[model samples]
Target: MASTVCGWCGDRTHMTMVTDLYQLPEGLWPTKGYSATPDRDLPVWMAAFRCPNENCQRLSIGWAPLHRAKMGPTKDLFLREQLNWEPTQIRRPAFPDVPKEIADTASEAHACLSIGAARGAVALARAVVEATAKAKGITMHGIAPKIAAMREQDIISPLTEQTSHQIRKDGNSIAHGDIGEELMSLDDAAAILEFMDALLDEVFQRPAKLTRLSERGTQQAPGGSADGATPVQGGADFSTPH
Candidate 1:
């Protein structure tokens, strides 16, 4: 079995437990030879894959037949194909601090890539950028103007501004039914989604986090030094109310 992707963390590898599964010991694997796909005529083996990533030792439960996934000559489409996974791999990471609308659009973009919709992913990524710009109070008429406003206000770096433009162009092309050599692969889609995440972090997530942290500190901080050695609120005793 070749490497597979973990839906939980998007870790791609030969996640198979033992390099060789044909040599299963007795009582190791229960095999009723269940056919998950009747037309394919191949029985799928379901198991928990061993994750090498210590930071994300997530037990990925997956079902696959003994055949390799379909791939281009040199690249993977990140297509679902015949594999069935528990968590479902999408390049989306958690964005708890972003606005609900923006987070939803960003997840939709990544979800498009998970099913091999590179063009759709690119298009939705453009939407995310525009939405982010608007959320930042840059309610301009067009993407170019909105992005320019963001750049002028230092809301986004020059590189990020460029990414926003390219995504906008590609999305425009798709809107007019002419993708025109833009986003030819899933890797391209992944890149756009990364840009989306960066945009969200820069425009929304970071600021929200900073404000939350500031408020929480003010609410929870003891009236003392940083270290716990200092007395808190003059060593107030709460056993009896004053």
Candidate 2:
């Protein structure tokens, strides 16, 4: 078996093996599997998998170097080796266990939401997740897909579907065009960010422990700030430690 240092931590994590069977020629399974074994290289057909950190309970997705031939073939690879495997259409991430970071972002998002600024809401929500992931040593790219997969695993509530969809749309707006006038309202942005923060909190920790806006207060629409700026929401005080 072989090992590599986890990107988030210097701790050397041994490779574990996983295998998945794909339909031949027709290309039925778009994704492949990896073994838990650290030494096994990716076969032309298989995808590589590794733990994001030695202490993490979940695994991360990665492609083996093309020249190495260290993994098994994609189609014939066995999935059983993964033990606790979950297939995803896109790459999955290794989120760390950090609640305080998420709480801070949520607080900022709440403040933005209180103001009713769409752009600010979106920007703050993105910042919260990005910062949380960074502190925990996770990546933000493809985070939406990762959340979607987590939903499918029933690790979080199905209600997350709406939040994931909105985030995807928000990302598209930022990348391709303006956030649009409708998105400028603080209330609209706050609601979306609140949902997003809830989702991240669930992903990083226990689902039951996730935040619920309904429990806190009515889902108020953002109004305007003191100087006629966009309406904003109150900062969230997570009385319970994350």
Candidate 3:
């Protein structure tokens, strides 16, 4: 048995065989058994495996077929049905440098997107833009004006402003029940989320990284000479004066 990542425990483990291979009877086959080509032999297999992790010794049912490959034959497991698998809430990306409230709202928007809540996702995305603008001290009557103000202040790029405005418009359509605007689709919601990620990266993450690097350079430079060489501790410079 090859070592594989256990989905339950999130650990590397060798699967333990729990059941014998069971092949379906030929009478149940619909004209053809699992073979892709007539010349190749039919390959059908079913078995159960147990996770080796002591904490998560869950059983999983698997089905596969021996596939003919260009190099040789290979076993391909197409189905992995874990009876003990429990659905977990989707995790959202954490933006540590961003304000806690804004980050949490953005995370909720992402979680909504993951579960096919497109309208809710877009609504929360619009909220994120508003929250971001407010956090940046850009006070305006509407989202569009706030976005434009941000653009004028050079807080965000023109393209970012345009995208944020568009997202706001889309969310407004859903919120106001506009018959003219189509309901938010999954693709549209995903695109909005992507734009939000880019905006947050530009506004928070990149600047934080640059600030940290600047601080580090300043700290390191104190011990270095003007010529970019580190000064020896307790040693006098003996170089000829230029």
Candidate 4:
């Protein structure tokens, strides 16, 4: 069994090995299973993996290949490489609290990041911010205006507004081709993604959490007051201890 992230459920769990490491057929090996050819010293293989999550016991697959190196006549080589394994080994994060439209755009941005399209991710990060603003009923024409409006409405804090403006500028540069994907570093992509998550959390998740808290506070038990106290016939110091 191997551990990998389930792409479907997005869980970090074990995957039961569904098959032994099977060597690729010689007939199909020529095309390298419709992918790039393997190195001369490496051979292709396939394996099946099934998720252990009962609700998500779906099957996934991957390709495994062994790399051989010859050091001496008596030397034996042993190393294996697997591509596109189950669990995707990449995060496809979910912004459940964000509005559906904004969440979808953010997901695409994350997909680009996971695939190493750093500039595309950054460009789309800007789009996500715009979508979030629109979801909040902000009708400004640009990210800067929208951010300023959000600050005015108390939708975002002053510090966040300042940082968001900077992100908007970076996103604009990337979107207009001023910064190319090859020029964007992985670190930059990661940092921008973190900011996106934080912004979404503040705008959506926090508000939703507060609403839930308010609803709970207003809820009343059957035959009891909203404050959770039940009336007693005698009413002699019936209050519960704090």
Reference-based lDDT, each prediction: 0.65, 0.46, 0.66, 0.67
Shift of residue 217 alpha carbon in model 3, Å: 1.1
Candidate with the greatest TM-score versus the true structure: 1
Put down candidate 4 lDDT per residue, 109-157, tens digits, no spaces: 8877655466788888888888878888998677889988888998988
**Model 4 lDDT at residue 223:** 51
Q: Is candidate 1 or candidate 3 better by TM-score?
A: 1
* Global local distance difference test of model 2: 0.46
lDDT of 1 by residue, 1-242 (tens): 22445566676544554322232233333343573324332334555656677677667555554332443521122223333456657666557887788888888887777655678888898888888888888896988899999999999989889888878887788766875643456566667777777888778777776575555555556654675342335333324321
Give the residue spans of candidate 3 off by over 4 A. Answer: 1-89, 179-182, 225-242
Q: Which pairs clash (backbone N, Cα, C closer than 3 Å) in model 1?
A: 3-13, 3-14
Candidate 1 Cα errors over 4 Å, as ranges? 1-9, 12-93, 181-183, 220-222, 226-242
- The alpha-carbon root-mean-square deviation between model 1 and the true structure, to one decimal in Å, is 10.6
Question: What's the TM-score of each model vs. the native?
Answer: 0.58, 0.36, 0.57, 0.56
Q: Rank the candidates by lDDT, best first.
A: 4, 3, 1, 2
Question: What tens-digit string does per-residue lDDT give for candidate 2 at 101-218?
Answer: 5666556555444322346557656655445444444444665655555556565567766676676567557645665654344335646765675667666654423334333334
Candidate 2: where is the Cα deviation over 4 Å?
1-98, 127-140, 175-177, 181-183, 204-242
Candidate 1 least-lDDT 10 residues: 73-82
Clashes of each: 2, 42, 0, 2
Q: What lDDT does candidate 2 reach at residue 227?
A: 46
